[model samples]
Structures are given as structure tokens and as C-alpha cells.
Target: MRVHKFTFAALAVAAGLTLTACQSGEDGAAQGGASSAPPGSPAASAPASPGGGSSSGGTDQSGGKNSAGTGSDGKGTAAGAGSDGTGKAGKCRTGDLEITAIDSTVGGDSDGTVAVQLKNRGGQDCTLSEYAGVDLKTSAGSLSAKRTGEHPGPVVLKKGKAVSFGVTYPLNTSGGSGVRVTGLVVTPPDETKSVTLAWPGAATLPVTEGTGSPVKVGPIGSAGQGG
Candidate 1:
């Protein structure tokens, strides 16, 4: 009986040790499973970053806005750039031209005509249009010519080429005193300065009193041609 009791006790102790070892093995397996999960898994200890995805998306949208704003600024700068007037050789100035007057004749009740010639003395080509401003100066006063209704096209004056315009007036009228003109003052189209040329001794433009606008000026045209 004593030996049987001792064997029974030894068997009980071994069973207890086996049970403890099995429980410890189960706990170790649970801990290892928890540690082995990937960092991006749903059950991870770190909280989910909800803003991270939205922040990346917002950065892309902001990049588009920045590019659009830069494009608008570039277009605004381009729109503000004006034409530099290089096309069409620019308008002619008074200093780039030479002015002179030549005697001319008109038929049928018209007294006489004076062809005012304009020569391009500059190195570059220029444009001339419209009627030149003419003033007849005498010892009494000054008389301006009336601008005619003729509309001529723009005349491009190259170097050493000439253009002409005419002034027609009545020399003497019936039962009126004749007025004498001593000098002629000519101004180029769209110009402020003027040049004076002496009147020809043989060709005298006599303006009669009581005649409204005795002088009429024509538009600029080719040299020796009526506008």
C-alpha cells in the first residue's frame, strides 16, 4: 500500500506539470500572433490616418490651381504689349519732306491752279494722305484755302519720290478789285510746322472781293496729276 500511494502521487505531479506547460504554450502562441500582424493591418495599435489620403489629394488640386494662376498672369502680360508702329513704315513728319510750288492751268471759268510738290528727303519710306494746309500771305493779311471734297488714298513716298496737291482760285472777277498774294505757306498733312515758299513773279493769284473761299485745295496725289 505505501508503494502504491507513492506511484500515484508521482503520476499526479507529472500530470500537473504537463497541464501548466500546455497553458504556457497557449499564452505564448497568442502573444506571437498579436506581434506578427503587419503595421498596415486593421487591428494595429496606431489609429487610422483619415486626413493623410485627403491631404495628398488636396495637394494635387492645389498644384493645378497654381498652374492656372501662372497661366493667367502670363496672358495678362502678353495682352498689355502694344504695337510698336513698325509696320507700314510709320507716318511722315514735317522734317522728312521738301515742299515747293509750281504754276498750273485749269480750263473753263477757273482762273489758275498751283501744284504744290512734296518730296521725301528722308532715307526711309513714309506715308502721305489728306490735303495739305495752305495759307496765302499778303501785305494785307492771310487767306486760307478751302479744303475740297476729294478723298485720295494714302500715297507712299519713297526716297526722292514726289507727291503733289493743287490749289485752284479765281484770278479776276467781273466788277471787283483784285487782291494780290505775295507768299505761300504750306503745311504737310497731320503736321504742325509749316514752310514758306516765295510766289512766282509771272504767276499771280488775284483774289476778288465778295467771293466766298476763292481758293480751294485738293488732296495729295501723284506728282503732276490732279487729285
Candidate 2:
């Protein structure tokens, strides 16, 4: 009887030990799973959180860099546009003009007028807003013509177009007492360079920059126009 009881107790103790070992292994596995995701698991493969991981953070940084670059390019383009807006054609120069004495008196000498024409041979358009300065070349000295009209408005001289003005001088009708003019030196408005052109008509016994009133120059206009 005693031996049977002892055998039964030993069997029960062994069975209890096995049950405790199984329970301990199961608890350790559950704790490991709850603490962190294992490698190659679905949780480990998921994308990073908004503010945390390498993948999402790198993408956001790249987007920020692109936005900054775009802003810099936009500023440069705006500055270039401003610079181009201020670029306009300049005034006409003497080297760009073809100057000539077109017509003069046929018979009369006193109060005689000469038409001076200026054509733009410059490849581009230019502005001419005032009277041209004229000087009659003579044996005595150069005679400057006085402006006769009011202030003229601005006019654009397109390429290949022409503008004209009149030069009026008095003649000494007395015998051999008049100024003898050979040529003219014309200076365009607001220009420093000059152009020389020969007098269109007779050189002797007629032309004189007036003694009483100065020789008169009319405002700029089209051909056959002006005072």
C-alpha cells in the first residue's frame, strides 16, 4: 500500500513541473511580441509615421528644397522683366542723318527762304523734337539762324523718313554790298556733331544773314511745310 501511494505522488509532481514550464514559455513569447515588431513582420514593413522615420522625412526635405529653388527663379525672372521695361530707343544723332538743302529762291533774294531736309538713314527709329541749328558759311563769318516759331512737340523719325525746316535770310539789294555764302553747316536738335551741305542756289551778290533782324529758322515739319 505504502509504495503505491509514493508512486502516485511522484507522478503528480512531474505533471505539475511540465505544466509550469509550458506556462513560462508562453508568457515570454507574449511579452516579446508586445514590446516590439519582429523583423520581416507586417508591422515592421509599414511606412514611417509623419514626423518620425527616414523615408517620409527625406521626401519632405526634398520638397522643401524644390520650393525654395522655384522661389529663387521667380525672383530672377521678375528682375529681368523690370530691366527690359526701361530699355527704349535713344535720340537721333548727326551721323545717322542725311542732310541737304532742297530748294531756294528762283528769282527774288530778299526775304528768301531755303528748305533744309533731314532724312534718317539710321537702321532704327529715333526721336526729333525741336528745330535744327543752322549756320550759313560765308567769306566774312558763319551766320547762325534764329528760331522763329513756338516750342515744337516731340516727333518720332522712323527709319527712312525725313523732316524739314526753312531758313530765311535777307539780301542786300545794293551793288556788291551783300554777303556771299558758299555752304551751310547743319546741326540737328540735341546733337553735337554737324553735317556740311553746299548752298543750293547762286553763291554771290544775294544771300545775307539779315542786319536788322537775325536770320530766321522755322520749326521742324514734313517736306514743303514750316514757317
Candidate 3:
């Protein structure tokens, strides 16, 4: 009877120890199998990156969309990016151009055209587009000429290269005085600044203001084409 009691007590103790070991193993396994990020890991603490962490390649970001190579409006191309992949050549500024004006025909006495030239004086390449703004400085006043041709799309002006435009005007042929043009105030396309050039020859005859303005300007073209 004493041996039976001792054996039963030992069995009970062993079973209790085995059950406790199993429970401890299960608790440790549950903790080790957790999916949550550990403390101090990047996934636990890093803030969300913008644009879903997508690379933008330096494009513009607006309205939660990428508008690369497009201006702020998203409808126009970026300033330095051209459609034909003329990358990084910016629009020509007035200060970077050298302007000159000359009579298109030699020894003109009547209606004539003036070939106005613009040379890219800057060290880098630039672009020019649209009609050049031209004003004839006359004895009467500054006579602004009207544009006459379709806009020649943007033309790349390489360093030291040049382009030309045309300005047509009816000279005084009635043996009477007409508008006496003395000089020219010229502005490049899309430019706010202007340059002044002296008229090629002796002062023009005369057509006083108020009579009528027949002066016309044309688009830019090859250096000597007179537009």
C-alpha cells in the first residue's frame, strides 16, 4: 500500500510538470509567430513617402499627379524642353541678341522692305519664335508696324548664328515729304526688352502721321531671307 501511494504521487507530479512545460512552449511559440513589426524597425516608424514613394525623375507634381516636361498649367510644354527633344535650350532673351536693320533693296526711293537681323550674341544656344516687335522712329513720332505673316514656330539660334525679319513700308514717292524714319526700335519675339538701331541711309522723305500707316512687319526666317 505504501509503494502504490508513492508511485501514484510520483506519476501525478510528472504529469503536472509535463503539462506545465507544454503550456510554456505554446506561449513562447505564440509570441515568436507574431506578424507585427518589431520596435525600432523601419516599417514600424518610417513615415509614408509622397506619391506612393514612386520616383518622379524631377518632374512637376501638382493635383496629386506628375506633369513632367509640362508647365504649371499642364497644357503647355516646359520652358527649356522642346517637342523635338531640344532639351535645355531656353527661349532667347532680348539682352542676348544683337539687332541690325538694313534696306532690303539697294538705292530704294519708293516703297521698300528692310531686312532686320538678329544674331545670337550669347555664349549658349537659345530659341526665337513669333513676330518681332518693330517700331519706326520717325520725325512725327514712333510708328508701330502691323504684323503680316504666320508665326514661324520656335527657331533655335545657335551661338554666333543669326536670323532675319522683314519690315515693309511705303516711302514718300509723291515728290512731297512722307514719314521721315530716322531709326528703328526692335524687340525680339516674346521679349520685353528692346534695342534701337539707326536707319540705314539718310533720313527718309516724309509722310506725316494721320495720313495712313502702310508699314508692315513679317515673321522671322533665315538670316538673309528678309522673312
Candidate 4:
């Protein structure tokens, strides 16, 4: 009886140890699974990247294409970069002009006869007539009310245009009037859209250089014969 009891006690002890080992193994597995979970998972700790959309000063963070923006260097960049900085671009068109004069001396005027040329350069027909008034200036001050002759009727110059006319008056030669042409302007008819005429610094009348003969003062331009 003693031997049987000893055997039974040994078996019971063995079974208990086996059960403990199995329980310990199960607990270890559960702990391992909890510790090794991916980040942000139910069993994890660290937070994920700053993703899903943080924002800036009203700028979207989704990296989408913007309507009024394209990630440029923040400058004045648009359609009309060189046209007028107005973000608009178009062709520069205008009517034509021609000027001429008669002088006795090269670079000098004895009889004081000056002529003008007119034409339509704006590819289309335009109405034009010599203005009947002029504005003169001198070092002393400005002088208005200069007497001018009656100009011809409004002439329509179609496309490639040219004309020559004359100005015969003994204009006073003194002060700034000697060399500087204070003003020479042209006005387009109200029907056409045109900018204010800015005549080049050319002499409205012919100017002579070395001799007493007269030379064309200005109207420096390019010929637009071919489009």
C-alpha cells in the first residue's frame, strides 16, 4: 500500500508541473502578440506620421492642383508678360503718317517753308486732316494761339498710304524754338480706338545738318508692307 501511494503522488506532481508549463507558454504567447503589434494598432503605442492632412495658412495640404496657383516662384508671371504687364497680349497696330518740307539750306531754313506728309499705316482706312492749330514753347514760357492755315479735308488712307504737304510760315527763331520741336501731335477720328499720337523728336519741318539745305526731321518707322 505504501508503494502504490508513493507512485500516485509522483504522477500527480508530474501532471501539475505539465499544466503549469502549458499555462506559462500560453501567457507568453499572448504577451508577445500584444508587444509586437504594428504601431497605431490596438496593442501599439507610437503615433503615425503627420499625415491625413495638416494645414498651413489656409493652404491645402492634400497636394492637389490649385486653381489660381501652380507653385511658381511667386512673381508676375502670366499671359501678357511683355505686352504691357497687364496680363494681356496683342498686335501693335496704327494708322500711317508722312511729313515733308522745303528748305533753302541743308540743315538750315532760309525761306522757312516746311511741309508735312500723311498716310494711313494702320492697315485700314482712317480719316485724317492737318490740325489748324499749334502749341509752341520757349525758355521764357509756353506760347499758345499760334496762327495756322486751313488744312485739307479728312483724307482716308487705305492700307499702304503716303502723302506730302507743305508748311510755309516765318516761325520765330529764338529760345527753345530754334532746335526743339515742342509739340507735334495727331488725333484719330472718334470712330477708331487709338492712343494719343506721340510724335518722335523729329522736326515737323525739315532740318539741315551741315549745309543750308533742309532734311527730313523724323517719322522713323518700319514699313509694314507684308503681314
Worst 10 residues of 3 by lDDT: 76-85
Q: Pick the candidate with the highest TM-score.
A: 2
| Cα RMSD (angstroms) for every candidate in the order listed | 10.0, 8.0, 9.7, 14.0
For candidate 3, the TM-score is 0.57
Kindly list the per-residue Cα lDDT of model 1 for residues 1-227, writing each as its tens digit: 99999999999999999999999889989887565667876556554357643232333454354333445446522222122254465567789888889877645645677888888888777777787898888655788999888777777777778888888777664444556678999999888999999864223445555746778888888336321
Q: Give candidate 3's error at residue 130 in angstroms.
A: 2.0
Q: What is the TM-score of each candidate against the true structure?
A: 0.56, 0.58, 0.57, 0.30
User: Which one wins on lDDT?
Assistant: 3
lDDT of candidate 2 over 1-227, digit per residue (tens): 99999999999999999999999889989778553678888667768676565353334454354333445446522222212244445678898888888656657455667889888898877777778888888877787888887676866777788888788776556667576878888999898899898887445445434474356788777335321
CA lDDT of each candidate? 0.73, 0.72, 0.76, 0.41
Model 2 lDDT, full chain set: 0.72
What is the Cα-based lDDT of residue 189 in candidate 3?
86
For residues 12-111, write the lDDT of model 3, one tens digit per residue. Answer: 9999999999998899798886546888886656554686663434556565654455566767565443323556578888988888887775574465
- How many residue pairs collide in each prediction? 0, 0, 5, 19
Which regions of candidate 4 fall more than 4 Å away from where they truly are? 1-111, 130-133, 144-152, 171-227
**Regions of model 3 farther than 4 Å from truth:** 1-88, 106-110, 205-212, 222-227
Per-residue error for 91 in candidate 1, Å, reads: 1.6
CA error at residue 44 for candidate 4, angstroms: 88
The superposed Cα distance between candidate 1 and the true structure at residue 205, in angstroms, equals: 4.8
Clashing residue pairs found in predicted model 3: 177-206, 178-206, 178-207, 179-206, 179-207
